[model samples]
Target: AASSGDLNWSLNPTYTGCSITGAVGSQVLSCSLGTVAGNTTLPVIHVQSATTPADCGVVSNQATVATTNGTGGDSDTANVTILCPGLAIEKTADAASVTVGSTIGFTVTVSNNGAGTATGVDMSDPLPTGPGITWSIDNAHTSGPLSCVITAGTLHCTGSLDAGETQVVHITSPTQWTGSGETEVNSCLGGTDNTGVYDNTAQVSASNVTGTPNASAQEAVLCPDLHVTKVADDASVDAGSPIGFVITASNTGDAPATGAFVNDPLPTGVDWSIPEGGSTGPLTCQISAGTLTCSGTLAPGASQVVHITAPTTFADCGVYNNTATFTATDSPQTPNDSDSTSVLCAALTLSKTADAASVNAGSQIGFTVTASNAAGGSVGTARGVVINDPLPSGTGIDWSIASGPGNCSITGAVGSEVLHCTAVDLAPGASESVHVVSATGNTSCATYPNAASLTADNAPGLSANASTQVVNCVIVSPPSPPKQHHPAVLPNTGGPDGRLLGLATGLMVTGGALVLGDRRRRRRS
Candidate 1:
């Protein structure tokens, strides 16, 4: 027979079972059997421990059944083990700011915690998108043994991380940014542990992480601009005189400008001349149909200069205007600039002539004086023009203006008179004439010389001369009739003898008639 006693049951803290009446390492239970059958089993006891243990080594739990009837005690033990793996990842960017049409780089680093090695590690980074921004990846990764590739605008990487080991992946944006404002870049890391435990444990998972360590970059874009100026060396010039112009073109933008050129229309009434050596500065310039074109290349904040020369052809007095326009590859519709100049020149001429080359003394002679304005550029008004006609000093000649331009005054008298004519204004291509008459004085047969002169403002003086001839006639008287005296004396003697004869007179008459008849007959024969 056996007396009633207590049995003790003990288990490891890692295990749990139905409560026994006692503290740790000292639990007690009463044992009794109502009926003993052949090979019948006592009331069964159970114990259990968690599948995963806090420590990675083997974990154990024990239970002992002892009787106070002075019999031996029996014990049983159970074991379990736990596995853990951790992974940590971080991503960073190379540049904080970038310009349009420029690139940016990114680097990703993955680290492992000391619990266990992480296997089948994978990383993904989606590129940012917006207006004016084009994103692309430059797979230049060299940080670790991980291989990185980009597809569908997303960067994908694959590798493994051992305990306390790390791997790296790299990505670059090779396209230019066209948009503005702040852009966000997000990435994620994921994998599984050797114990088949996923890293999707919590917000900060032991193996996988999402939307962390985002990098931001910036971009800027700009446009090109330009400025132009035109000027002339001389503001006023004479007709047929050369004038020089200097034109400058400049680029005010950050980029180089191609096909930069300036177009200038030649001023009216001006003739174009080839520049020195057929070029000005380094510019290629040409003039066609009264327009001048100068072309060259210009860089940012760079300037080019061109020179042009032309001669004035207008014959009228007025202002002339010239303009130039500048253009470039990047810039269009820029404002143009202009410059102007004046021309001043005049030409005058004088001439004098006589109506006849020779004149008779005591006859009227005519003289003519003319003034002309022959300027080739512009019509010129000649002022204070005077015509001086001084008759021959000793030729006994008198003169006065006749059929002339009338604004003339006669000074001095007759033979040495000076005719002064005033031409207030003379237009270009116009002529003025004055006529003077001179009377010759009675004198011996000789040649007389006469002259006239003219002077005017802004013109050279002129002179002309003419001559006249004087003539006299001579007469001779016939010899007196010396024989007539003898006939008169013979007639008086015949009168005394008239008394002796009527008969004698008859005889004398008859005798005279006979004698005259006989002489006439002899001559006829």
Candidate 2:
């Protein structure tokens, strides 16, 4: 028997009682047998592929046998098929977990694992299906020179890969690829999508080649984005005054936020308390170690608010910053907010006094106006300190700064009715004064009240008043004229006898007129 084929072949396990001879492509087998009956069963002969290499395609083997008794010879042919080259696909996600409304990048790689090139290789990926989840191709990462398109949310790519070669595509396009095929897609999970595990699959195939099983990758969807803000009721407040803060926490994500909380550390040396019903929504709050913490669950687009109240006196007379932080379960990052308020501690007292409390309305009066900041009761400097004394409408005033450690000046002329003194700044325990002398011009006598006020930056206005009394002057009468001597009148009494009679009459008339005039004058008085 003789055999020949395109592919190298040989007998298996050495057929006993038979001798074989040939190279890989051709072989011969011969066996000795005594006379035997016809149609007898013979030992089976097995043929196998040899080590010599062969091309891929159908291969054939022909064998011919002859009988020693002059029986007819038999010839038959056998064929074998050879296959090579393989196609495989792998899918991968950039992240194992992704937040809602965030982009999810994916990569699909097709490889040829066989020794020969894979022809007409193609890949298809329909992508994962979920609410508001869209897809596109990453043109830059996708293998060049390959025709690819997305049809009805499915990715179709056609190309050829050499042995051990790979072609890659990134499934991240928001829209169909343009002519250049380099435009990237910004596919993202919608904020309204449900949170769960999502899987993506891809497959590869080629002409006359079977591809590996579909490749898959899983990505977990997580949503818990929290935002927080803090707001103060007052930007600036006087010392010893009450202050309030409002804190808000909101969940702006697709999924419900659990175990969400806000933390606020109170200003140093300040005592804070959350009043009853201060917190809104389903939130429970507590204060410990001068810090306030509020915890609750929040659905998407839900928010919680809390109000904090404290006294400004506990903090110094300066800007105080308060911050709050928000955190939640499954939230990769936390958000915080802050607010600043100025605390004013300068406490000013104003006093005005007239030198003479009883000064008449038409008299000249001197006044002393003093403004002081309490040494122990205040903190920080008082800026833009001003003292105003609007005098009576008709009265004229003169003012001068008595003493102060600051840029001080008096506005208005010396004789003007209005007196204004301004001091640039005044430190705690500092004082400024102004001496004002005013001429109360002609006016009805009466008791009058004079007032002065002081104002400083961040400090409440203060006013003080002093009163002055005016009275009418007393009247004095002149001394009476010397009275006529009666002793001289004795001579006049005798003279009334002769010529004295005429002279005496005149004198008597004169004396009568004088006495009448004196009585009239006394009545008038």
Candidate 3:
């Protein structure tokens, strides 16, 4: 046979009886055709591809056979083609923009593009680098691979792919990105059938491919944080005493802070002062309607401190408290700090009085003594209260404590005894009274003076005096008259003289009668 078409025909090695006469490209075969009554067929020759290269695409071949050196000969033609493997790759990203400290995802697909199966397939991708961009492959998302590794910012994967088969890979962005408006580029390539391609944009390589495929992504950055606190120098203070306070503000984020201020409302019993000094910036402070405001600025990781003085002037005893707040621009929430203090002192009073101004001797006189504390609740309770009252000496009065507190006792004689009363705890605004009864002594008719004194712990002594008057009276009797006894024997001597004169006259008359009787008897005879 002779060469006929553009296709080159060769002799097969299995055909032992036939051989080529000229060069292989000349395609002239020398073989024996035995003589026969019917038809005879010779050994076969192979047809080679001319239009298609190896492993590129399908190549068609046509062969013709004809009878030579004979009339009315027959001819026949036949066609065939060749086939090879192909590969392709593609890449995609989940996001184009993200914040700092955020993660981004990427996916790569490797596929077999030819009709035949692809073996020993390999895929690789290089890490993306920019002003603030970093990347790494995610092992959890890589699938259908014999072996995979990430070393020195590069990912390598090996596996096999069938006809029209595909494989995928996933990667994540870096943990930090500080650059603003920076772009990140990534790509992937695959190789199979001992062939590969290199990509410029993705910076990756793939087998059985021509050009590289890649993807790009970008991100932005933003960050801000602020805090404040307050404290007082003293937790408790006396009335009208000065108190000091310190307030602090800080910015701990990666961004600057503006329009930051501290607000504090001075309580009713406090008098506030101007702000002293601060750090990181100049501080301006103002007070209006009992509210104090201090303003300043702070950079990243910067702080400010402010000092203030306040005086307390509360009328009664109690507790006082104050709170301060902090605010800033671009901050939605506000924070507060607070402190408290107490004010106190001690006050006491004493008084004495009597039930009557004057009293008779040996009569009872009543006296009342009172002790009180004038401090309110803010100061606290008074402790260790005592009272002493001694009866006066030589006052002609006997005195004793009749009714008093259970802790009181009397010592010495009634006329000069000392009465003592003690109280363990005397609460503020509370009072105690001591009653004493005194009786006058039966001594002389004169005026008697009396006095008593009261004394206590941590207090001054007080005294009171009183006097009583006594009366003395005198008695007298009259004298008797003298008696007379001579009237009883007065007239006996004058009556005896008259009786002697009468006896003499009677004797003369008797003598004259006897003379007349003798003359008459002589005439009758």
Q: Which candidate gets the maximum TM-score versus the true structure?
A: 2
Q: Where is model 1 poorest over a 10-residue stretch in terms of lDDT?
A: 516-525
Residue 349 displacement in candidate 2 (angstroms): 1.9
Winner on lDDT between 2 and 3 is: 2
In angstroms, the error of model 1 at 172 is 11
Error of 1 at 384 (Å): 17
Sequence-dependent TM-score of model 2: 0.41
Question: In model 2, what are the clashing residue pairs, if there are any?
Answer: 136-173, 173-185, 174-185, 360-470, 495-500
Candidate 3 residue-wise lDDT, 1-525, digit = tens: 444333355555546545555543355555554443455545455523342224244333333433455564545644343333466666665554333344655677777776655555667666554333456667788776436666776766676677677777777754342222333221111112211112212322334444444443332222335677777767765444666666777777554556778788876756677645433344566777888787866666777776677764434345657788876663433778788766554355666666666554456666777777676555534456677777554455556778877887777885567777865456667777778776654442345455655553334455666555543211112322433323232243234233322111112233112211111101110
- Which scores higher on lDDT, 1 or 2? 2
lDDT of 2 by residue, 1-525 (tens): 333344455568667666666774565566554555788877777767632123465666666777787877788988765545677788898787655445676888877777667777678887765544677777888884457888897888887777788778887622111121244221223222533556778887777475345798877665666799899988876666767789999988766677787888878756789888888877788889989998878887888989988765423466768999988764544789999777767767788887797764457666788888777532655667788877643333344444433444456654445667765566778888767555554343455567888876556788999876555422223445755433232433444223232121111233112221222111110
Regions of candidate 3 where Cα sits further than 4 Å from its true position: 1-319, 322-334, 337-347, 374-380, 413-416, 444-525
User: Which digits, one per residue and each the tens of the lDDT, describe model 1 over residues 426-485?
Assistant: 656767777777566554235656676766554455776666555331112233332212
**Better candidate by TM-score, 1 or 3:** 1
Q: How well does each candidate superpose onto the true structure, as a TM-score?
A: 0.40, 0.41, 0.35
Q: How many residue pairs clash in each candidate?
A: 5, 5, 8
Superposition-based RMSD of candidate 3 using all C-alpha atoms, in angstroms: 25.4
Model 3's alpha-carbon lDDT is 0.55
lDDT of 1 at 319: 70
Model-by-model lDDT, in order?
A: 0.54, 0.66, 0.55
Q: Candidate 1: give its CA RMSD in angstroms.
A: 17.8
